[model samples]
Target: MSDNSSKLHQRAVYLRNLLIAHVTGRSVNEADYHKLRHYFMGHKDTSRIIPSVLEKHPDLSDLWQMMKYNYASHEDRKAFIDSEFSPFLAKLSPDSSQPSQALLSQNQFIDEPTLLKHWLKANEMLEMNPPVASEQMKVLLEKLCHQILRELKVVPDPRQHDLTPLVSLTERSLLLSPGKQHYLVVKALVAGCSEAMSAIDNLTAEGISVITDQAAIPKIDKPTSLVLINLYGSLASMLLSGWRVRQMLVEGNSQR
Candidate 1:
């Protein structure tokens, strides 16, 4: 397995063991509530693949709330782990070994500078430096849009800076019209990707605090960045796949 795949597998194993300990054993109190907070802090990337954990216990600070004074949430949290997480973890066992990105074929990412290089750089800094990684994702998406336009023999609009405009331009170039059977679904997916790009834009840049109405927004975390990265890769794959179909159709028509 590739190094990224190995890391993903290790993370899956660790999380499974952690959850099992909580759900199993003699009693609920036997579980270490403090470890829950530690897991979130240390493994921020967990939510990238297994987001349900964060969905259940989003407030990391609240893990500390389960200290000696309070034990009300312990049983409830354990139950969630048993019902939702256990099954997911079971699939991740070394025998099965299915990570989120496992569904994506390796051929989707070519060994080019604009594509794989930036993705690797961004992933390296994903946990340690989320802001930097987020910036890389933006650049990757922008460059990909530019490349797609170039491949179509069209001049990309220099004014189209952000992802949404570039994506709209890409769609226009690809003839993503409303008359198609799956047009609505494709449009919705494209729109969702655009929204993800916008969300990434909102993430803290260069460690700079994002302030709104005198309130500072939380800095971009690993899980959020990873999700955006996954989304970007998926969108890139979709665009390229459509472009390839168009290219073949054009070649066939020209040959006729």
Candidate 2:
């Protein structure tokens, strides 16, 4: 099978085991997963590359198809074998001899262990002290959003999920006690603005209509109050809010 296919297969196995655990109220025995491995290797028609390993296995074909298609590159395939699949295989055969010295050193950093460790340490610090103010939350939220946008641009495949940990982290930092309520508010605000912007774009394409609302009345009578109530002034203020959101998304891109 192709590299992408292999990765997909491993992901399928992980998901299957997860579902089984959820349904049965028990985790799969990592050591006794011969059935799954056998199932993956049994069928034909797929597993083109590693067919010799399980050519005659009747069940391997279906298992192989689930994972073989998503591999977009050789690196992805190698990553799957080294990071996800090999660990499970290790669990299944614990008595196997040690890996070669080079492989052993490389395995130690699989799953980008350096990044994971840094994330864990930062998490521990946050847990201990806690974010106490909105300002702190704002800085963190911007950083998180920046990271999300960066990843979105780099990872072209639809199968790769973004790091949602940033969302929760920013949410937590922003509102300590009333986090849940604020989270809903933030979601609604973003959704509403996005919808409104789309509507504005559509409307502008047709033609701009200047409505003669009371707020649009001339300021000659009461210049100061009229300035505050003028339709154009109000529209400009509203436009600024939308501009800010655009700036936020844009600023994040430049920073990276």
Candidate 3:
């Protein structure tokens, strides 16, 4: 399996085990709790699972409230799980399985720098022998654009036709003078920011229309902002790499 797939599977298993322990009155270690928090806060789809789990085990209502409000102490969480969840725990068979050791040991953290690092590696590979066809370059640019958008959590509007503008801008930046190339790259990055901001705005409006908790607004906005910043950083790195490659080619041609 691919490394990403494997890591995702491991995380899934770990989360499943942690949930089982929580509902079954088993003592959850600090590592498992931390992993749970990481998954809860980091992944949108995974965060939805908490509500589903709560629905199934309403006895965990207090625990869920504490967790949601960010007021649950370690001792309080442990005590509540052991005492309040007893009726639900009694129905479960004894769990013999442990959390995945591989997952525990693996450092699967992803941030802007990590994304940029991978982008640079791929960019270097392309630069080693520039693709022969302009069409091939366009295809690569489209892939990079989509990857950045996906990472930024920017869902494209169905009304919009394609990413041709962004891709063309990126491609144009590759052949420009160094100073001009930087400006073009910045423009391309700004286009990405515009799309990302639009997505964030739509989501914020939707969220606010439904959930009106003023305190929860910052919790939502902070993460969204961080995600946008990270996306911009990665997109900048990708565009700058293209410019850097162009510079190398220009210098090589001049020398020849």
Candidate 4:
């Protein structure tokens, strides 16, 4: 088998074994199984053409090797996935009080930067050398860019003390070597923030009629305002990771 084919086979086997363990309730934890399952569900429609990739980018052997050994044992892998996803899932209400039909029916629109990252990557790969690599690169880049935007939101709104830790976190994540786990954590945060922010912005822009009560409005001072702007630039840096990942994926894909 070609190297790409073999790697794909190994991943497929790993997934299958995980599923079996999950069903047996003996090997994999329930939470980990669900988390890994959700990641796959999120991109179920995408095709993973491993053989074609190997044919295009033969040089990926070393990089793939680096990634292969990094994953922990299957059990540890599951725990990591669960932890990465737990925050996002926790936001959903368990109580049965039904949300308004209007709120439920609104077509969820991902935020501007998130959507832009996806569309831009897709556009760039339209005439690329390898179709599969081009698409994967696009998705990875989109995720990275959206993640940066999410970090922006994490920085204190300037109503608090220094966000040095938050800033450090953003920089640390960005500087890490590319790997599947890193991508997952960053993407989940990005997707969550993108969804939340879009909802907030939409509500705020819904004309003055909908927001008749201005009595309790809070104001931001100059330092806070400047901090917010700087936060935006910091987000821009993270967003650029998508482009970098895109270039790498595309280059690798083309070689196949």
Candidate 5:
């Protein structure tokens, strides 16, 4: 299966199981909770069928509501997850009937161990300590950029603290030729990853926690942090996976 398709199928199964777990009563895992929140709650653009499903199941809807307000501070609590959750996750083979593929993919981090380690750590601290997670995210981005540059035998400037320049350099390093057909998508992915990280950086800086109100204007709260972090994971992992494919093609050509 194509990488993207594999990711989507794996994600669907993962969220489906998470939903089953929620109805069954389980500790609201921070990663799992935020993932579901982004997919089903605030995102109106999600598949219409999903909302219809929720409409039919008030039990699921009520569980989601409790999660929005009182449960944000409690990662050990539970909620619901829908989609866009799987894109950032590591790719899993289709037969891996294990719905825990999300955690399995996370543990594999597969290509980049250090980046994955920091990413997982940041995920764990989202509810308990968002600021620290944000800081770790910055560090994760830096490590990713430096790793990409180093792979191309290019020395990344240690003084560059901002993510844009670093991400741009990594993108260029990943695809040395602007004329390459895949260059545009690679550039877009890198740019998206950088911008999303910037948003996360800003939002997490303001201190995101379990704050909710239907009447009040939305601020950078715990829900937003979870959503954006998951976005960051998707963009970054897709970029890395693409880079891996490029390397494999290069290796195959060399062997011939």
Candidate 6:
């Protein structure tokens, strides 16, 4: 077998054993391990089997414990295994093999000029009439909430799901070295969004026309608005930083 094939075969066997050990609470004997290894190494459809094995054994505590036993630091073990397994797991699933290009595109930062244009349009509508402008702003905020959830990989269900926890998770996942300001801003944005969604639900329940009835328009508190603006600014900075990093990598590769 080719070197790559051999490596894949070994990994597959290793993962299979780990799953078995997890489910049964007993390690596979060396003889059986070798037997399974050889069988899978010679099998034509090993790639197809790996995902099935993983899916059947969704609880990964055994494998995690094994990694912890081998590595001293919690962070070290997590980083190492995630880096190793993510690629292998992606290979087993057709949908995950390629990155979500559409999602990535949608999450890219809107430029200052584009943002200014939107602001001008919103202002014009407000100037013409409050009701029309209130409706437009409501739609805009709802869209923003959807966009943020999508970027954070959360499937939004305003009526069914309590989004506060998911927002907390998103904040934890995205902010690597958040400061005091970051904490306060993220907290405000999450609370504000939640409040706005709740108000929407209440208005709808009361049969209030959110578009026509000015009373139905959700009032965004000053702190929430300020925090949301800061959040957008931070997102823009992150996008710019990522762009610069990618450019540097490309330049380095070309030079090499």
Highest-scoring model, TM-score: 5
Q: Tell me how candidate 6 scores on lDDT.
A: 0.38
C-alpha lDDT of residue 256 in model 1: 82
Total residue pair clashes for candidate 5: 7
lDDT, candidate 6, at 62:
40
Clashes of each: 0, 15, 0, 7, 7, 0
lDDT of 5 by residue, 1-256 (tens): 4644443433344444445345434433445444544554443433443434343444555765655564442212311232223322222323334232233221122356745765775677565434334434543454455556666787656444345667766766776753365566655655455566566567557643332321111134456656655665665676676577567666766798
lDDT of 3 by residue, 121-201 (tens): 334323211211111222233445544444334544433323345544444444345454355554453335335534534
Instruction: Give me the displacement of residue 62 in model 5, in angstroms.
Output: 57
Q: What TM-score does structure 1 among the candidates reach?
A: 0.42
Which residue pairs come into collision in candidate 1? none
How far off is residue 231 in model 2, in Å? 38
Give candidate 1's whole-model lDDT: 0.49
The C-alpha RMSD in Å for every predicted model, in order, reads 18.8, 23.7, 17.8, 21.0, 16.2, 19.6
Error of 1 at 116 (Å): 5.2
Give per-model TM-scores. 0.42, 0.22, 0.23, 0.22, 0.42, 0.29
TM-score of 6: 0.29
Task: Give the CA lDDT, 0 to 100, for residue 39 in model 1.
Answer: 47
What are the per-residue Cα lDDT tens digits for candidate 4 across 82-148? 3332332222212113211001011233445644554443333232212222222322332343345
Which parts of model 2 are misplaced by more than 4 Å?
1-33, 47-167, 170-246, 249-256
Query: What ranking of all candidate models by lDDT puts the best one first?
Result: 1, 5, 6, 3, 4, 2
Q: lDDT of each structure? A: 0.49, 0.31, 0.38, 0.34, 0.48, 0.38
At residue 114, candidate 3 shows an lDDT of 45
- Which scores better on lDDT, 3 or 4? 3
* Residue 63 shift from truth in candidate 3, angstroms: 56
Q: Please give the lDDT score for candidate 3.
A: 0.38
Which candidate, 4 or 5, has the higher lDDT? 5
